[model samples]
Target chain A: MVAKRTVSEVGEFGLIGRFTEGRVQPVSTLLGPGDDAAVVAAPDGRVAASTDVLVAGVHFRLDWSTPEQVGRKAAAVNLADVAAMGAVPTALLVGLGCPPDLPADVAEQVAAGLWAEASRVGAGVVGGDVVSAPALVVSVTVLGDLRGRAPVTRAGASAGEVLALAGRTGWAAAGLALLAAGRETPPGPVAAQRVPEPPYRAGPAAAEAGATAMIDISDGLLADLGHIAEASGVGLDVRSSALPVPPELAEAAAELGADAVSWLLTGGEDHALAATFPADAALPDGWRVIGRATPGAAVTVDGEPYAGPAGWTHFT
Target chain B: MVAKRTVSEVGEFGLIGRFTEGRVQPVSTLLGPGDDAAVVAAPDGRVAASTDVLVAGVHFRLDWSTPEQVGRKAAAVNLADVAAMGAVPTALLVGLGCPPDLPADVAEQVAAGLWAEASRVGAGVVGGDVVSAPALVVSVTVLGDLRGRAPVTRAGASAGEVLALAGRTGWAAAGLALLAAGRETPPGPVAAQRVPEPPYRAGPAAAEAGATAMIDISDGLLADLGHIAEASGVGLDVRSSALPVPPELAEAAAELGADAVSWLLTGGEDHALAATFPADAALPDGWRVIGRATPGAAVTVDGEPYAGPAGWTHFT
Candidate 1:
């Protein structure tokens, strides 16, 4: 029988070597892990960067989500933020804190998840720091390349522009609803919640087509669009009828007696792209027109304000 | 009297707005916060990146150090990593996790501390995320520009090269000993453990002066030098008599009946820079030679293998 090695037993440096060994790094990485710092190609003279923190109990539960799922979701969310800026992800630096008693394989699974998601977009996990802590905390910082194009910010939307969205919106929220209700959910939506697949290609495509402003819908449709509205000094009127509610979400909502539309408007962590474009400008394929930018600052659905909760908040 | 507000009361977005409202961003930032991602100028078509995670009760204690000290130390350590690569820090991304019960001022103090240290290096805190957790965790990712110079990695030391160091050694460990012994120490050494002042300038100076290899001394002199020796496939013979032991550490060692040389050899968190230069190369200012690289794998002191505790281990 094999003896199970804990993180504390292998030590910090040993664990890092274990995870980094035999891993193939993306070509964009000039230098990979094992150095004090890693060198990655920026290519465009500027690098786009963002960070996110995930706590064990606050952001995820070990019992509900596998270590692999947590790692993949963490990478996906940060990559989504980079994509929202109309940039291609080049590298990621992960900072992880785990309790000493954790099985070494669990940490490896987390690293595997990070590598899997990063490989999907041709990005590399170039460097990271691991330390012992009271609970598990994963912090990811993503670096992206703009490719000499202008970054699509949240403050560029104008009145009379058309608001649009790319990728699924309500799937993750529906999965959350199922988890909260203690009901078993289908594998598709459950995986969607655990590991989001954001439409990364749509971001650069929309930027190429001249998107006025853009944001990743991590904090729900209405709440995230509210950020663009607040930044650009414009209002958004989303048409609820135009929202593409997945059939699974609709069926789940009916079974749970919950409103699927609420999930569409206020469910968070879908990592979908929401943006605005000129009324006459042609939008890239996969982007569905959901609303229009208006002169006022209020975010409304079908011209009336959203009566339910706005979106996810870190603190209650 | 004003009621003390917790992080949850003001909400995550509200707390972020409060901290970032009037903060001045560094000039290297092409785009600052309040967006999906921030853009920092990389200049030489490449970026040097590293990350560090600090957890409460592990890396620091709130009762012993102020939030400002914690923040500054986090930034300083990561900046030291960049400097070890012979690069100048340009930007930082912070990810913070705190319990909802944490006072809002505590979080602000942490951010203030980060901004203060970053400004010293002419870098900006371009982006960050805040989330509620069971403990306070500060994860920092620093980006630096090499300005078209070749990165000084750990694999270049030659057998005939001279091993040298810059900045204070064993000061932080001395301070930790004082703290652990429940004795009062002078503010200088005490502050060293809380907030390190790494010799950032010496890195590029050594690089320009044609140093063979470099590493930040976060994990003690012998241990970090061991990394360089292993990577460069050379042995190091350090001269214990030549080590620069600060006067305060000597005094403290006398009081505790401990050997200051132990701290110098095995103490961690000083964040000094250790490097190797050609035997005949003129030493740069602020650097002192204390050893030489040899042809074998063992690290020794004065031709003898003097082994006390080698260095710190995360999970002993």
Candidate 2:
């Protein structure tokens, strides 16, 4: 049997060539990898940009996820940020740091995952840098074209607005709970945890449908909505009964002796799009009306403050 | 004295607020930090992008350089990449990872350094992310505006073109050597090592002057020139006598029994701009003739292959 080669053995340039060689780029990528910088088309005269960092153990454990899964998560988080701004993703620049002893295949798989996720949204991996570090660190920066629309910021929601959500929520959190309890019987939630299916088209659709405010639900429904409430100086309330609870999530929660509704309200990482539209505005397809914006500055559930965990936060 | 607050004590949001709050952005920044993503003006209808990652031990040692200097270095390296593409830098998105125990002030200083350097080029720090990790990692992505000019890539040089250089070389290498020898007498070189001064204007200037090929001298003169040579299918030969050996570098080398010319030929991190132009093209101010492109594919010094170490490379 052949021994697996480490990243150190392949060297930085060699590893970079392996990851980028012969990969096809989308039309938006005017100049791809092999240059000092890449040129990406932003025909709307403006560009939306975002960055996200993922660290090994802190963000993902190799034992719990494939290197590819980690890469997909990294790209998904940043791509979702771009979509939340009502923009179409155009290009991605990746910065990868790896331990010397890490297998070269792991790094290649991570790159493949990033490319796969980016391709799904018609974006290209245009440029990147590879270096040595104590642990695996993947940083992704995404660029998007706004196509002549104003950005839907967290500060734009107002009183008398209808709150809506696009895509699934709580499934990732339930999957995490299942994993913690050493049960993987329900592959649905576990798969959601591994790779999120963010409603990418719903973002631009919401913008076209006159969304007043928007944010990707990265830190759970209640916690992320709290951002909109505080930024827009309005009160937000979510109807617990309105949130769709998938049968798989409910089954997993029942088996784990947990509350599915709580997960639906407070669980995160599904990369769902949560947005606010005018009371009279028509919500986009797949978007369900969940609640409304009021005249104060607090986020509530069923007209009362939620009594469970708020969501994910870094550091403490 | 009051105890310094650690990053974990401040929490991720608090740390981010302290670093980004009240900072002024340039006109190109349509939306600054605190949003899911930033909107930056790209009036040229295209954006040039680049990403670079710096690790704590491999890229910078806190003990040898101030946190602010380290941050400046991080920003400079990436900004230089954008400049090398003959584009005007418009914005920066930083992804920072830190140990929980790292001082909050240290992190703020790092952000300040990044802002200072970015501000020098009239660019804005538009967005970023802060996450917890085992060590300090700074990943920066910069966006640039091409202003209707074609990107000056490494693949355009041809035989019979004159090679020219803008900005100093060997200074940073001398500084690193001085520090390694436990002697920092020459403040110039030591400072250069801490924060590189990339000639930001020279890139576009060279492009305007009709440069056939260009590259930022990050991995040293010969090594980087080799990139252009290979990509453009030409050979590059540098005359040793034409390379500048700054007086401070020469004095430091003399004291340390080192070769100043070798540093001039092989030192990196100065981010000097090197380009090949039509033989009769008028050189821009601050750029001096150093070599010429010739037939074949080898990078030579005074018509012979260099026998010393080439330049820096990550991993092995």
Candidate 3:
């Protein structure tokens, strides 16, 4: 049998060809890979953009998560950021740093996963660069179209607005807890942790329904809402009883002797959308009312300050 | 005296605030940093985008270049890619991975350099993410507007066209050679290696002048021209006598026992724009004709194959 090839053996240009040769591009991709730069359509006269970087040991472990999973997470985080702005993602540009000794197949699998997630929302993998580094570092930049709608920012919330959430929270945190405890019997939480299913369409739907403010829950609910509260100059109060904690999380917490509610409050990386709407506005499908924007500057759980760890802070 | 503070001491949000608090954004930045994502104007209904990843020890050595210079190089490279596509850069999004122990001042200096370079072109530093990593990695994504001109792609070159160049070459490579030889007497070459001054306006000028094909000479004159030859299915021949070998390059070459002509033909990273124009077309200002496109495939110097190293490949 032939020896397995490393990225060094395939070379940079060859590896780029492998990643882009047969991929299909969406209509928004005016020009795809294999050029000095890629051209993407932004028909609304504006483009929404965001960037995120992930490192190997700090953000993920190769032994615990597959390269494909890591790639999906990278794309998901940036895509969710664009969606949080009430935009439809149009294209993704990746800047990947890899060790020379990494298997070619592993790098290709990572590209495959990026394409998979981008294609899920009709976005194209437009362009990328790969270079040798000390460890794996994935940097993704996503571009989106506002479609003639005003972007929903975190500073639009007002006091007396109803707080709402769309999509699951705390499941990824529970998965991390299970993994840290070295018990992975329940597959749902672990799967959620690997590849988040962000509510991509809910952001625009909420925008059309008159969402005043919005954010994606990459940090814990309290910490992320704290951002909204700080930016909008309004306080927020969450009713703990209204949070939907999946049964799997409760079961895993029971086995681990951990509080599921704490995970729901402080765990991050679930990529759920949270927003505030006028008290009289209709809540969109898949969204449920959970709290209200208050008159002071603080994030409270049942009108009391939360005492658990706040949220993730990189480099800390 | 106050002790030095590391990035970990500043925290992610604190560091982001430090980088963004005092910066001024251009008109293209509809919404600047502080929200989940930034919105930028795309007046022509399409945006040109490119990404490049620069890693410590691979693309740069901290001991050889200042953090500020490294940051400039990172932004310059991606900006050059957008310029090569005949577009005007509008915004930049950075993805930075830094070691936890890195001094906060150094990171601030890096941000300062990025802003300095972007502001030169009227582009805004729209958004970014910073995370903990084993080594420093700067991933920059630059977005540009086409201004309604069709992009000058590599595949448009035709036989019987005049080949031209619009910026400096071989200077950065000579500086690298000087640094490798442990001599710093000539400051010009060393400075060129530290930061490149790409002829950014020349790209759009060439497009407006009806350039048939164009590429930035990031991988040396011969190697980058080879890309155009392959894409456009033509042969390229450079006249050795017409190449401009600057006096400083000749002096550096004589002292280092290297051939100055070879450096002019094969040195990379000057970010000069090389393009093909119709034989009867009036070439744009700052551009000089140096070669011709032929009726077959191959890149030649003095009508023969180049025998030295062609260019760079990251993994190899």
Candidate 4:
């Protein structure tokens, strides 16, 4: 823990000076932070955008997650949405809220995490705002480039299409469980909770390969699949026998006496990409076919209705 | 007040459906909400961005402001920043944090307010996140287009330049003072506080006229100009004798026994446009010559130090 630095210690202007100093904007950003607004080149003539807000205690526990981890997650989640649209991320805008008593370093670490993750997806942060609040809150909005490719949406999936996933799953959920259990140390699942490793390039790859529909699994796999089904007006059937589970997740589930299948089926926050394609489509690297789109508006596991929790639902 | 319908009643997906239905995208936005991210056109090959956050108690009091008012104010402040950049606003992404107990109609009204104001600016509310929080927090990120014009910044103001303002000044401050005083009925200043009318087109006008630099007066006129002076490393002197004082502001200042000059000179949130131009530059419409730029780095009034409060500081 660090001693808190009063916000007035570095005046609002002074804090802005610290946050913005020496940062280089991508060539696409014609104007950045110092101005009223930042100007970025949208060369493809179209831009993609999404926004998310992560609140303290609700989105992450300060006691369990470092500010840096929170920052990375904040930026990464929005970046995943950009990628989900099959777009090249170009610029980001962040709005941060914190108590005036919060340490300056915490703010800096958050910015660092945001920058690091944004850079991973080849994007730049162009502008931001810092305001006083009762609790720490980080809100991020990402703008992206479609690069002349048509956007892949959740409503485009069709009957007889193959459902594939191009990233890991259940790790964040496992990590959340570990944290809930009061584990003093970071285990594989707990570590997964800190920072998700989304497969960034797979989204564009799926789009290039003519994906019929696409979505990112921020909710549990089943819940996300249901979103595709509802949007595409079809049914989805997951083959539980073919489910992929991380070895660490399996071990952790065994120790906790929890069903690994439950986590694999319903855990979320791994930001894995899921898309439906024609039967003849070629799968991209890292993609695993876990299910198939069917004619009826229902979901099943191994062709049967496996009894378990449906998935994540907002407001419990 | 109407009966409050719990947000949980509509559910997150239901609320999204209510907000996004019937929304029209400009030719610029190829994809709108319901997709992972929206696609909008930036034909000029550049995009301008800015973000701001408003807390329930800090930025606006729910008791004094309707949810719709809060939404309009939230959008206005950010859009003003984009206008300050001499860019035409294109899209906005909103992130809202509210308690589960709040009314869904309140949220919808907020969104409607957001849409109304964005519509006024000829922009779309492209995408957003809705999450539960302890209090209401609105985060808005604005994306704008340069329209092939170069961006105007605060740094280009130099010595031997005339400083002028285009639009109302001190009204919002007087408005705030009136609101704080709690008159039985709404006063002119209070109305100004509720909704500020920014000089939206003046930025491009200044840029087109070869103005050296420009900024919007979100803070007091002196303080914001101080930014331009500090950024340009020059001095600015405001001529109080030539300043424009709206009668509404004058009456409120007189009623409150406060110095009207101080309010007009150092007050903020008027969203007025301030800029410096060459000695012989032609000022734009609704503009008044109020000062000049000099060789040193400081802000003054009528060639002397204005003996009063400096300006608005957020935390204090």
Off by over 4 Å in 2: none
Interface RMSD of each: 0.7, 0.6, 0.7, 1.5
- Indicate whether candidate 2 or candidate 4 has the larger TM-score: 2
Instruction: Name the top lDDT candidate.
Output: 2
> What value does the lDDT take at residue B274 in candidate 4?
91
User: What TM-score against the true fold does each predicted structure earn?
Assistant: 0.98, 0.99, 0.99, 0.95
Give stretches of model 3 more than 4 Å off.
Answer: none
lDDT of 1 by residue, A54-114 (tens): 8898888888799999999999999999899999999999999989998888888898899
Please state the CAPRI-style docking class of candidate 3.
high
lDDT order, best first, reads 2, 3, 1, 4
Which residue runs does candidate 1 get wrong by more than 4 Å? A1-3, B1-3
User: For model 3, what is the error of residue B243's alpha carbon versus the real structure, in angstroms, after optimal superposition?
Assistant: 1.3
lDDT of 3 by residue, A1-316 (tens): 9887999999999899999989999999988998899999999999999999988888777877899999999899999999999999999999989899999998898899899999999999999999998898999999999999999999999999999998888888888888888877688888888888889999888888999999999988889999999999999999998986778988998999988898888889989999999999999897899999999999999999999898877867
User: lDDT tens digits, residues B1-316, model 3?
Assistant: 9889999999898889989988999999999998999999999999999999989898888888898998888888888888898999999999989898999888887888888889888898999999998998999999999999988888899999999999988988999999899877478788888888889989889999999999989879899999999999999998887786888898899899998888889888889999999999999898999999999799998789999998777787
True contacts kept of 2: 0.91
Query: Which docking category, incorrect, acceptable, medium or high, applies to candidate 1?
Result: high
